[model samples]
Target: MADLPELPATITVDLDTPLKRGDDAIATLTFRRPTTVVLLDMSLIQLGLVDMDVMRDLLTRTSTVGLIGEEVDKIDGADMLQIARDVSDFFQIEEFEDLEIHIDGDIVTIPLVKPIVRGETTLDELRLRRPDSGSFRSLSLARIGQMETRSLAGLLPRISMSPLTEADTYAAEPGKQRGSLHAFLVASICTLARPGAIVDINVAPDRQQWWPGSPLIDLNPHGRTQNKKHRALVPVLPALDRWLRAEYATYIALSQQDRAGRGWLVNYHGRPIQDVDRAWDTMLTNLELPKGREWRSYLLRHSLATLARNRGATKWDLEGFMGHSDGSQTEVYAIGEFPSVVTALEGIVADMERLAPGAMHRSRTEHGLVGQLSKGDENVS
Candidate 1:
């Protein structure tokens, strides 16, 4: 057996500003463990070095025997694990014989045996394998179960709701020329739901006509493609349909004067029209759904993709519907090619229209709003 590297006497700790309470500061500590170094490097890459600085400070300050409580509030579990691996690596330790982590509310106590590293390859294997037996495995299993339950719970509400009413369906129709634009938006989102494909939208041109007076949706404000400024819409077709229809009705009701001053739709005097974000929020809130922002975005795209998948659409078909490039690489490697993507979208839209014909109806009937007061007390006076 190869001898292990010597353990460092003290480890470096870092703390964030928010955790800088007088006596109790939250800190993260990283030691010289090989496994830890590997994990920390990955985390640093993911979070960026700038973000890791505060964490590094907190860890260094808390490593002392008596100062752990004084220098830290609550150690981050992920950070601590990464630090432990780093410490193991630095000391050339291998095979974590006995390591125990106990969590009680905000407090966590980790007791680990010193590792003895053999060679680089052996050390790599040790880091990848399970640290010990029993408790860790059981705890991990329990955590997985809890996460699965939470995910299932999040999906339940949306699945159980009944289809929208006919009157509501008809209220979403844009004029003849704009109908295709709405379809394109819905189709693009459906395309994204497939396994792997990049989607981009050119909103500037559309925004000019669709939102004349509104601020331009800038694509390159920071000169970085990865920045949030260039985020493209890949809305789930069903959700987009639901959202767009609602917005159209709300906008039309509030905007009274149509293109030719033809009072075609019933006007709501004083009711605030639904903006994009507000419309999405209202729909999710009404359904009492709980999903993180990113997951919600994925769900929106997934909803459309799922529809396309169900219709037996070719992947290439779906891609075309989404306005994606139909290059050879895309045809061979992309999950949702044009054919499949388009069919799924068309099928979903047709199903939704069939089930909820009123979804496209924008006209407000007297029966739809019996006692609801008009905006600005217009009906009251």
Candidate 2:
């Protein structure tokens, strides 16, 4: 009333349709007050660009916000987030938690929290998340390309989900044949999900059907229930074969003892391993995870499956490779075709070689791979 003009009661902005990035962007917002309706013209950073200076200017309650920047319109995500944050802060609209900040592209809306009721003020857990990498970006073709670029050594530290079950911890006894068998089990688990999913040494007597040198390993012969039991020659790399052979050697040695054992693989000292949980824990510990971090046994499978999906693995390929049963009244087996899974796994192996050189090193010291292979936890690398 003394010397200043009255501010607008309401403001409505008109940004160009289909917000894009560029330099020659011009935007206007109309401010309507009881006295008069004023038009405020502002230069926009091109292609839907927004910057800090622009944000600051817009926040000001004066006509000076219409000034154009002397520099090029180089707006980015940081700028946009800052502006959104400022707007939210200024508005302080806590009741309507509909505000979201993201770089628009190939968008996916996951149902994270469901509302309690349809329209009433009932609310659910408020959560916000954005995709860092994946098909969420329009230009990104291979969403899993991020994972495929990582080395086994590098991926080791990133695995957050640890052993989920208490029963998975205390697996077996420290037998004489423990070391070699442990190596065999560790190698097996790393290659696929559950040991039985790949090759239930206990169930499949005819596991070595794909020849000695071939990378493919067919664990399930012909059954509707067993690990989706089909024979499509799932690709098992040389690294896996090396471990399999080591395991077989132990199993064969144990066979000579004429002792009935549960595991198909034996130890270097000609003894059978009794516990799966023990072997899993011992192996993960050697992987050098943070002390006391529960190492999930199914992590390798998850990694394999995730990478495979990222590389465009089909449901058929995934189902076959994972031996997933559809829970049908009578088990129905899809034609065993796992080409995509194999391809994805190959790429993963190649990436591992590039990222972590000598991630898998097998050596024969004076003690050989015995006693060392006993506790089931060795430097599996």
Candidate 3:
């Protein structure tokens, strides 16, 4: 990367203040395997060192898709099956055949569910259902008799997707371009916290618990994306609160002002975003790189966990961050550790809120994202 002038010259800047803390925190990362350069703050600063550059590369992107295809250069069959299982579990599919995968844009959904679910993915059969309902997978939900996500991966008989548009079908490249801000928005959210799903969320003006939420989108009433364990908001930084308020304000304004009355926070042509995957799909399709390049939807999630671990997050902190609810049924273990976990996660979450230093370039005006928020523009283009 240093060989090319297209990359900015970071060597001149002195990143002292945060680097000092990072240097001190390096001790915390000793337990991490392979002894990777653990940047306490992975923000951009040209430290004028070969190691920093390598570390930045390591911290920013981690492969979520581990399998490599033999010929077409897609995810390997095993990896694809693994992902298929994740998708199925996250969406609460009774059978693998129930999944309705689509790529008209970068989206995956399940039309079989009530209200038709969509979001990013994860989980197992025991982990599939809500905590209040039952702890693990049960035969009541069986289409194939108490099947697990992994078991069906190799033998899923049914999966479907929304029909493609005639124009998309005919055109060589029908997907549209998306702004970098959108990429940062999604990446930052997933990077900062456990993401149940990456689907669209409805944040209320005052906030209230709502229902029938997508598991991937935080199985909650108000439906704001939340931590799996604490149920606190993901992207748990102060800046997230500010930006989210801005988003909610824009949504309220748009819904109130629209002549056609579309009540979507994000929309296309006076319509609600029926399938939230459009935004996700657009972001990926717009990347100007080789198809099936290094990044994938789940990379942000993996990157966050790995980076957090590198920065000294303990196992309990990780459990809180990841929303792992599978411990002993008693409340004693979590209740005792919750406070410490929250404190440790606070710093890691803050680091995630800040975009990977130098990876994103913005003065905030290129896309008029701020302008759209300030003016309450409905289109987040």
Candidate 4:
């Protein structure tokens, strides 16, 4: 085993398998300190860093020159494992040396940065403010169990002096506070998809499973792309449609190789975005969320499902829209497009708009997104 590198360290590794980026065949990767939360969503530290998926995720988050999932996948197996081992060494070598946790009754505080306070009464910390049972005034048992957004949104404004206003307590802060692309990603997940399903979407005019003309997105479950039979038609509500148009226009303009390449809809320099952990973390930071309140993009899926159900969408409707029924017999024997899916999605979008006015607005025009209208496509309204 090699010695662990020092804090804020750098290490370069020659890749056994080079990646193709335009005319360049990149053959090396230099990793740097993972500047953000290394594993915010990982609850069981006991699982360790040996897992390939976890290591791949960490590598993407920490890479100095930046790497997309596709690029990371091309890394040699031996090299990848060694990189993971190096990461484990760098992060876990000195376990208790620089660790700190403070608990005060219901509040648990963790300060990532030093507080610069010139005056009196300055405490540098981020703490959780737990709400007592009294916080659930008019909220019913059923609504709470269902995780209804509207009810929870209504309740959150009362919990803090500074209530979260984006989607009540559900979403991050307003789109204006963060870049429009960030807001677009958040809103897209909350309204139309599981994060991976949308993030991996390919929008090349000829290659995509569906197009702007289609009201439904034929989402291939992220890791199961090889299984062609398994796909779900997720509804594109009005708000989601606007976002798709904007993103599509931007994607085309940037990747003039429109007829070639994978055509990943959400990309960095035309490369597919395989994971969004870093983006999610960045959004949370912009929101100034308390340290302990880290959120995953998957939660937006939950919010959409619960919000739709609360607004009277049937289980089948949600199942169809969310790809929950993908591998089941429903996909083969009796899988017809469900009108209720559209209705349910529309309800969720309406609720989002009503709860936080203009929360779903397209703010990415400056990024060259055209938000184009369809040319009388039968599938789109």
Best by lDDT: 4
TM-score of each: 0.28, 0.41, 0.34, 0.47
Per-residue CA lDDT of model 2 for 181-282, tens digit only, reads 344433443345464443343311334433334455655544534434332345666656555545543344444335344234324343434445565555
Pairs of residues clashing in candidate 4:
none
The alpha-carbon lDDT assigned to residue 183 of candidate 3 equals 30
Kindly report which residue stretches of model 2 are placed more than 4 angstroms away from their true locations once superposed. Answer: 1-191, 195-199, 202-211, 221-233, 249-270, 282-295, 325-337, 361-381
Residues 1-381, candidate 4: write the lDDT tens digits.
122233446777777677677798878777875532454433224226366776677678778778878878877788787677766664563534453656655444555333424222233444433444434555664664544444555444333222123323333344434433454354454445666566656665555555666766656633445353334665566666665666566555554445366446565555665666665565456555533332455665665565455445667767766666665665667655666556655544454454455656655443333423354322221
Best-fitting candidate, scored by TM-score: 4
Q: Rate the local accuracy (lDDT) of all candidates.
A: 0.34, 0.39, 0.32, 0.54
RMSD of 1: 20.3
Candidate 4 residues lying further than 4 Å off, grouped into runs, are: 1-192, 221-231, 251-259, 290-294, 336-341, 366-373, 376-381
TM-score-superior candidate, 2 or 4: 4
Decide which is better by TM-score, 2 or 3: 2
lDDT-best of 1 and 4: 4
Give one clash count per candidate, in the order shown: 73, 19, 12, 0
What TM-score does prediction 4 earn? 0.47
Model 4 residue 352 lDDT score:
44
Cα lDDT of model 1 overall? 0.34
lDDT of 1 by residue, 266-285 (tens): 12232222222333344445
lDDT of 2 at 287: 39
